[model samples]
Each structure stands twice: as structure tokens, then as C-alpha cells.
Target: MSEGPLYPPPGAPTPEEPAAGPPAQPAHPAYPAPGTTPPPAGWAPYPGAAGGPRPGLALGAAHKPGAFALRPLGLGDMYDGAFRIIRFNPKATVGAAVLVTAAAMVLPLLVTAVLSFTVGLALDESGEIETSASTSEVLAFLAAYGSLLLSLVLAQIGITLVTGMIVHVTRAAAVGRRLSLGEAWAATRGNRWRLIGLVTFLYVAFVVVLVVYVLLWVLVVALADGPWPVVVWGLVSVPAYLALTCWMWVRVYYLAVPALMIESAGVFGAIGRGWVLTRRAFWRTFGIALLTVVIANVAGSMLGFPFSLVGQLATVFTPEYALLALVLTQAVVSVVQNAFTAPFTGAVASMQYLDLRMRKEAYDVELLREAGIISE
Candidate 1:
């Protein structure tokens, strides 16, 4: 029987020519053939066949596309990248984050409850706001709040550092093998101190950069001998200054932590290794890191827009609805803010340093081989 619509009763165009067989090619005259196996991954070319290899037969080896495109990295890009990584490793990323989030939320409430009880006791003893909760009370509240906030920030930083190391180690593990929950915990545990020191160094570096920038601003303002021309020159140089600062940090620290962790080196040694590895490819390194940021931001916006839309929709109803809308709006904003930032942060952690190692150290091949995805 004819193959229905596809065959059209015997001989139609046979639905796009029944897939062409390999084309015929006359041999090239006076071509010198290559001797020996001609090395791996360089070139093999098409084998010489009367009619070259069948058109349907796939050629050579399949290859992955190059690194994500180079674009300027931004805050938004990091969040977008984080979410993409989250999607890929939902169990490790979202699952662990949810548990961590719950802990963060509950711990604060618990502290608040205890502090409220303590405040109640103070009120009972003193029996007057002015007397009981005077300067001491005010100062106590300020101290408590300040400590709480600082501790929260540091805890989050620690969590971020640990989470990042876990994610990378997990991803690399996944390429060739699977990791149990216990195994992930163990890998992170093994790497914890190194990761913490790495995180600490980065944190300090960021602060130092800020301090330097502030100092420059002060210098610029003070050195401005009372005219628009000096101010204009100073303003014009801000971009250059910012770029130089960024370049310096990336040059000094880009792959340092990874090298430190992988090689177990000292801080200065790690910095030197990173510099050497990233030496010749500053722009490419910058571009890939930047592109990762761009991709991440786009992804985060795509994710966050929905929550923000729902929030905006709540505003259309009434004044009472407005209060509810306000709460909803803030909640959505908080979530979207976090979502937007998390991805690129993760991406930066993953890609920039990894790219440096690959380019400089041939670590990518070692990585691929270690994962058993490639052999030599």
C-alpha cells in the first residue's frame, strides 16, 4: 500500500526526495595524502569515498557550543544565571535554599520572641517607659538591632560561600557521577575552611575597593580648586577609574580561590597563579564573565516579571485592597529581588574562575577527563 499522504499513491515527490544518498564527487587530482594518524582533536577531515560518506551518516565528533556570549556583566545578570543553575540542580539549589530560608526566618522570630520576653521583664521591674526604657533601653535596642543585622549579613555571607562551593563541586561531580546527600555534605565540609577564607578575602577586597573609591572621591572634591573645569575633568575620569578598579580586581582575584582550593596554595600564591593563568586573555575573560552576567540578568527578569505583574494587578481594586496590595507588593519585591540577584552571583562564582583555569591551566580538559565525559 502507498504510504498514505506521504507517498501519494506510488511516486509523488516522495516527500522531499526520500532523503538524498551521499553525493558523488570526482577525486581531486594531484592531492598529496597525509601520512600517519594525524593527531587527535586537530583535524581528521572527511574520509575519501567514491561518493563521500552517506549524507545521513553523522560526521566526526559532536562538540559543544563555545562559552556563553560576551556582554557586560551586571547585577541582573547574576540573578538570571543563578536561577538557570537552580533549574538545572533544583535539588541542590532550590531544595537546600528552601531549608536554609526556613531556618533564617524562624531563627529571627525566635530571637524576637526571647527579646520581647526580656523587654516585658524590664517593664515589670521599672513600670515606666521614661524610667524603665529610657536611654538604656534605647541604646539596648540599637545595639540589639545592629548586632542582629550584622550577624544576619555575615551568616548569609557564610551560607552563600558554602552554597557556592557545594554547587560547583556537585556540578563537577554530576558530569561523571552522582552524589548522595551525604557525599555533597562531605565535599562541602572538606572544602569549608578554604571556601570561607576565599570568601573572606573577596569580602575584604570589595571593602578595600570601596574605601579606595571613597578616598578618590574625597580627593577629587577637595582637589577641585573652586571651578567647573576641574570638576568636569574629575567627572570624566570616573569611568576610567571604575574600569581600572574592576580590571585590577579581576586580574588579581579571578581564579585565585579556585586555584587555592584545587592546589592548596597560600593567598599570595593563589593570586599569582590566577594572574598567570588569566594573563594573555584579559578581554576574553572579562567578556565571558560579563556575558554570564547578561544571560543571568535576562533570566532573572524573565522569572521576576510575573510576580511583579501580579503585584501591579492588585492595585486596580480599592483602598482596602491597596493595603493588601502593599503587603503583596513588598513580598513580591523581596522575592524578585532575591531571585534576580542570586543567579548571576552563582554564575560568577562558577564561570569566571572556571574559565580562567581552563584557559590558563588546561583544567577544562582535566575536568572533562575527570568526569569521564572524555578520555584524552
Candidate 2:
């Protein structure tokens, strides 16, 4: 090579300097020195560092440029992160939830009104069923009922879309970005059908399993001749059925939607990914999921209680308009419940997916790099 200049080129290491290699191991292991790795974009220096904390170094602990620290999350982190995601971007989370919930409920509400009207036509002024109902009225009533069922199916699809959107919102928030409703919608658009398919498959499978269990219970009861046999079968079979269903629900389906949304996995792929992620962590995953559901449900019920009480009072005080009052109250309750619980549950599921990946796949390092806190 040509003779080197008096000093190394501006960016090159000199003789006394060691060539850049893996970052130096910090003296404290947990808190790396600020200078070693650049801080995440917009990150402030840790207080009391030599000059100031480096841009990338976490102030006092783990780097958390978003809803949570870039490390395996604790239970508190999961819950807090869920709330933070919604708070950080209400337009994407709660606003989308409200719109989706309202849209999903619309058809059901209309079908309910039609069914109520049709049924009312079949009832005499005395509130007794008319024995001479015409074929047209009967068909209309049946059609309304059929439409109600179809609306319910469509509602399930809408719920799936909301869940997928929330997953995207949580993912964006994790990277310190707040997605708008339209952005979240765009992010999830490609995965909507896959999510719906996954949910439909799960629902159908659950129904099939329940039917089989019921048929088996009936057969067992029919084959046995004594009351003691039925009681004994109920005692053993019911617990077994419940346990099996709960286990499958937790181990197989708990993380499927998140996998589908985040990994762009197909229906079966999402299920398989969920199964793999939960391997050797069944109890942990189940406990967290169950607790989240319980908390969401309890909070929803508490929030809806006022409306429910108002509905009850309305019915008691105004019998003539009782149905209208109850329907209106129920609608309000449903909106409030869905708006709050949907996002909360979706956030928890997203956080769980992230936590599992970090724990098992060293995902936090990748996240740090993606956040530009470190070089490739």
C-alpha cells in the first residue's frame, strides 16, 4: 500500500486504538456506559453522566423509547403497556374501537328491530300468539331471524378487524410511533381476512367440540341405568371437558391473532406460531391471558352497571316503553364495553407476543437496532 499519511485517515483507527469490534462490555453489565452505543433517536442523556448520558443510553435503566422498556416485560409492564398504547394513540385504539363496534352493532340492532316488529305482528292485542298467522308473516319472521344470525356472523368479522387494528396500534406504539386510525387500518388491511378466517375456524372448532362432548354425555347417561351413573358421569366428564377446552383455548388460540397480525402469518401458520411460542410456558401464558380477560370483563361490567340500572329503572317506571328503553340501554352498554375491553385485550395480547419473543428470541436487541439505538 502507499505510505500512510502522518496520522490515520479521519475515520480510521490508529495504531494505539483497537479496531472497532463488538461493543465493549460495560463494567456494570446491566447499565452500559452511554458512549458505547448511541442512544435512540430523541433520547435524552442519563442524568449525571460524564458529560450527559449519551443519546442512546437509557437514563437509569433499560431503554424504553416507547410504551415499554426494550426488555422482557413483567406483568406490570404488560398491563401498563396496554394502557399506554391506548393513551398514547387514542385515535388509533379507542376511536377505531368505537367506530368498529358501532358498525358491527348496526346490523344486529336493525335485525333485532325488524324481528321485534315481525314478532309483534304475530301477537294479538292481548299479547297472545295469533293462531291464524298467515304464511307471509311466518316467512317474514323466519327471514328476520335468519338475517339476525347473519348479522351476528358479520359482527364477529368486524370484531376481528378491530382486534387486528389494535395489534397494529400496539406494534407501532412499541416503536415510539403513534399510528392514526387510517394508518392502523392500512397496516391491518392485508391481514383482515386471515384474522377473520382464524376466528371463524376457532369458533367452529369450539362448537364442534362442545357438540361432541354433549353427545358423549348424553350417550353415557343413556347407556347407564342408575341416577348415580349420571351424577358420576357428570362429575368426571364435565371437569374433563372444561379442562380440555380451557387448555386448548389457552395453549392454541391465545396468541393466534397477534401472530397473524404481526407476522403476516396465514391462519394455520398463526396457530402454529402461537403453539410454538407458548411451548414450555403454558401456565404463564394462560395466567396472564385469563387475568387480562377477567380484569377487562370486571371493568366493563362496572362501567356498564350505571346504564343497566338506568334501563331497569326505566322499565320499572315506564312499562309501555320498556322495550325501547332496554334496547337503548343495552346498545349503550355494548358500545362502552366493546370500546374499552376490545383495545385493552388487544393491547395485552400484543404485549404478550412481544414479551414472549423477547424472552425466547432475543428480540429486544433487534428492536433496539430497529429503533436506531444501535448499528446493524
Best by lDDT: 2
**What is the C-alpha lDDT profile of model 2 across 1-376, one tens digit per residue?**
0111111111234224234454322211134465666544322211121232225434443367567777888899899789877766677788877776667567646754665555543444443335687777566556655654565466557767888988877765665545656667766766777888899899889999999999998898889988999998899988999899888887778899988887777899889989999999898988998999999999999999999999978767765444445556766787788778989999998889988989998878766655545555
Every candidate's lDDT? 0.47, 0.70
Instruction: Write the residue-wise lDDT of candidate 1 on 1-376 in tens digits.
Output: 0110111111123223234445322211223346522223311111121122222212221111111211232434433434434444444444454444344444334443454445431322222223536675565455445544554565466456545544453333222222223433444544466666775787788788878877877787787777785668677877877797668666776666655644545567767877887788788677666666576577667776777777656555443233234334444443444443443455465555655555555655544433333444
TM-score of every candidate relative to the true structure: 0.57, 0.77
The C-alpha stretches of model 1 lying farther than 4 A from their native spots are 1-85, 111-148, 170-174, 294-344, 347-349, 373-376
RMSD of each: 14.5, 13.1
